[model samples]
Target chain A: MANNIYIGVDLGGTSIKVGICDENGKLLHQMEGPTESEGGPEVVIKNIANYVREIVASSSYHWDQVAGIGAGITGFLDIKEGIVKLSGNLGWHDVPVKKMLEAHLGKTVKIDNDANVAALGEAWGGAGAGIPNLVCYTLGTGVGGGIIINSQIYVGSTGVAGELGHIAIVPDLEAIVCGCGQMGCLETVSSATGIIRMAKDAVERGDKTSLALVEHIQAKEVFDAAKQGDEVALRIVNRAAFYLGKSMATLAVVLNPQRFILGGGVSKAGEILFAPAREIFKRFTPEPAQEGVDIVPATLGNDAGVIGAAGLNLHR
Target chain B: MANNIYIGVDLGGTSIKVGICDENGKLLHQMEGPTESEGGPEVVIKNIANYVREIVASSSYHWDQVAGIGAGITGFLDIKEGIVKLSGNLGWHDVPVKKMLEAHLGKTVKIDNDANVAALGEAWGGAGAGIPNLVCYTLGTGVGGGIIINSQIYVGSTGVAGELGHIAIVPDLEAIVCGCGQMGCLETVSSATGIIRMAKDAVERGDKTSLALVEHIQAKEVFDAAKQGDEVALRIVNRAAFYLGKSMATLAVVLNPQRFILGGGVSKAGEILFAPAREIFKRFTPEPAQEGVDIVPATLGNDAGVIGAAGLNLHR
Candidate 1:
């Protein structure tokens, strides 16, 4: 099975990324195309099929050598049945993605949420490689989590496990309404959206800070300003770090994963975010659960999705 | 093999309870003896050995019929090596409990934390019987928790996994210092100590309530007064139930266990605690994760520890 290959599709609202990997997890070929989600689920499905065929056709391996196909889709999913339960980005609801792809490609198809796929990719080849029990946090617009137990994705009974951001760690007094309609979720403070929200609030309150001058503020701009000793920016960054670390401490006692891999846009704030998180994690976690446990930035970055989707054929 | 039996020991500060269970998890014989902890670890170990021997001698089964022995003790433990890391109740530290028991009885011996053993008991034959993935919360003086994944205890990297009560779900503004020294742990607000603390605070604030008349306050009194619609008592019970439900909602997205089993002294409050917790759980949890999950009282009561200890030989 040395030449046995798998096709991975990282499907998003804007584009579809296709990659082919050999049994050893080495990428042999890649391609991309517009998602055309405006054309609805039908068009997106067709584009994914075309990309899979295009990637395999451009590679040296024959179609017969491809073992299976997998897609890292955005939004909620019925993973066992390969249905996209609801995806705001893709404008899909109850779409039978796996069935359509398998029928078109004539290969077995597997699908999972983008977060879980990213985690599988890291566990297969990135930061958490070879560590069976690890959790991945993707801190983009929202905080997404994926739990890998004994080298497999742990989808709770209904295939919706590992929602770390919503762990309600905030007290009622300090809590703001979360997008999920809850109060004081980790996402309300730690995510890129949350960081920007805090920065905007500080500037709106006439706080003394450099952020007020920036016409368009973003999570990155807040981090950049904080690096230059902007007090308000620092406060926002610290608040984000505080809740993020607190959520990790909460998770430390329950899952106790050996490594916590941080990814997505906001995590790139570097040590400005990670330094305080590590310190807070140590302070919050018990001695036993804290020992030998590590917090590290994700290594794969954007490619984690495609690579992780590729691994689904083997790891899932 | 039909007549094969396993010996279980539930060791505590006050007493040591022993039981014999067949392979099918039915208890066949039982007995109890004083812990005699005033004499230290050696005395406790000897008492355990004698109790196991006596239980078998009094039963119909002979020595050959005893397959193994398991002890569930309070405190930190190294489950793999069967070492009681630090048990305040037993006044033990770095005790090689499994090795000593095996050498004394000539049978395979296993040891685990009391909470984990009790969880295994419920998973094996108690409330969560036949359920593979379940989390048990024992809300006694402190909130203790155990995780059962695939019907086995989930000890993390350093044998400290399943510290469910330590999850920092409470925010700082509404937080109190927990016994574990962390601020705003679920145990700080949801445990029996926390309930009593709230009751004390109500009385101190000079709130007009029936609780002020009761000189010696207990958790049961709070529940009794709440049943009678005492304003202060209902407020205290509601706060406790709120945190407990919130913590379960937080855990629901992470582990997605099939059931959340509530046990210990506070759980005895029945629907006054459960009805509100269930409602809060539904409000906080995402629909998919909440679909089949159930919050129910533990059925095994006091026998859970002994039965769960006996099951360690087969399950762990």
Candidate 2:
């Protein structure tokens, strides 16, 4: 019998990443292409199909060895139906991604939201490897999450199970309206945007801080300032970590996952952000739920999406 | 071949309730006996075995029809090994229940925590029947929770996945210590114990209310007073309902279960409790997650425990 392989596509607004993974979820080969999403879903999907074909053809493996194809899409997806209900990033709606990609590549195809795919990738091939139950938090512009249970992505009744960012953690008195129109969401205080907004609010109020000296305030700058012992920056960083840790404490009782994997750019802030979150998680979570659980950083970096998407064919 | 039947044991401190169920999880027959817990694990095991034999012999079915036996125990348990690690109610520690029961009956046996068992009962034969994913809350002395996913109890990595009562939902400012040592837990505010405590606090503070006139206030008295338009009692009920609704909203984005099943004595308050909780769940949950999701009462009541135990053999 011939060895089987999987093809994964990480469909982004600007560039689409493609990778080939062996049965063990190892990325054997990879390639990328321009999305041209403005040309619409048809063009973007065509680019994905071409890149997949090119990657497989370039590798030593033949088309027959490609067991299936899966794509990690950034949008509200009808995962069961393989439809992209709405994708603001791609300016697409109601696109039958699986059908179109299967038609173009003549292979079985599956699609899932980006957060879920990335979490699966981490579980299958990255930090969460060998762990059947864990949660992955992508702390970038927004706080995205994925719940992996028994080595599979846990998409709840409405395909919205792992929306950790939207958890209403902040008390109503201190909360601001989130882009999702909710007040006091975890994202409203923990996301990069939230941190920057807090820093901007501090500066406008004339608080004493070195961040006032920076021309542009990004999450990285705030972390750097906090590392330099800037009081205001440290407060902002702690505030972000506070809600994150509190949310994890809630998840501890609800899911009791064995591990929590943090990924994405904000997670790159490292110990400064992690220390406070860990402390708060310890303070809030009960002892039994936290006994074997540990918080760790994601290892796959930018490749989690493609790797996880490839795993969809196997894990799903 | 005769149709197979399952025996379920609901082991409480004072009494042992046993039932027989068919493959479909219907409770065909039930009987109860004194636990005599002071007699220790051996006596309890013997009683369970005798009850099983009696129920089978008394029924129209033959002894050969018994497929398996399962017990729902209230305590810390090592589910996989079927050991009662520490059951405060049973005064048991490190009792290998599955081995003891199997030794007597010569049949396969399984055990799970009471909360998970009750939730499974609701999922299999009551309110959550036919629903693949739902969450059940037993609002008794303490708040107990069970997560049902894909028609089975979702016990997390360490078998503590559905400890929803311990969610740290109350904000720090208004937070109180929980029995589990955590502060601001949902159980501290939403459980019957919590409601009774609030009623007592209101009376102690000399708040003008009818509850103060009652010599001893139970959760029922508080609910009854609130139904008659007592402002103090209404405030306590609403507070309890508030946290319940908030926790459900949190579970909405985390688990996205299709239905929320509320059971136990506190839930019997009916519209006064359900109406406020439904409104708060709607107020807090995001539209997409809340869509198609409904909150309803658990229909099985006390029978949920036995039926759910019977289902352990099938669902586990």
Leading candidate by DockQ = 2
Mark the regions of model 2 whose C-alpha exceeds 4 Å error after superposition. none
Q: If you assessed candidate 2 against the hidden native complex, which CAPRI class would it receive?
A: high
Give candidate 2's error at residue B135 in angstroms. Answer: 0.3
TM-score of 1: 0.91
Error of 2 at A243 (Å): 0.5
RMSD of each: 2.9, 1.1
Model 1 Cα displacement at A67 (Å)? Answer: 5.1
Q: State model 2's lDDT.
A: 0.94
Error of 1 at A139 (Å): 0.8
Model 1 bad stretches (over 4 Å): A1-6, A22-29, A34-68, A103-107, B1-6, B22-24, B36-50, B53-68
- How high is the lDDT of residue B17 in model 2? 96
In model 1, chain B matches the true chain B with a TM-score of 0.97
lDDT of 2 by residue, A1-316 (tens): 8899999999998999999999888899999889999898888888898898899899999999999999999988999999999999899989999999899988999999999999999999999999999999999899899999999999999899999999999988999988887778899889999999999999999999998999989999999999999999999999999999999999999999999999989999999999999999999999999999999999999999999999999999
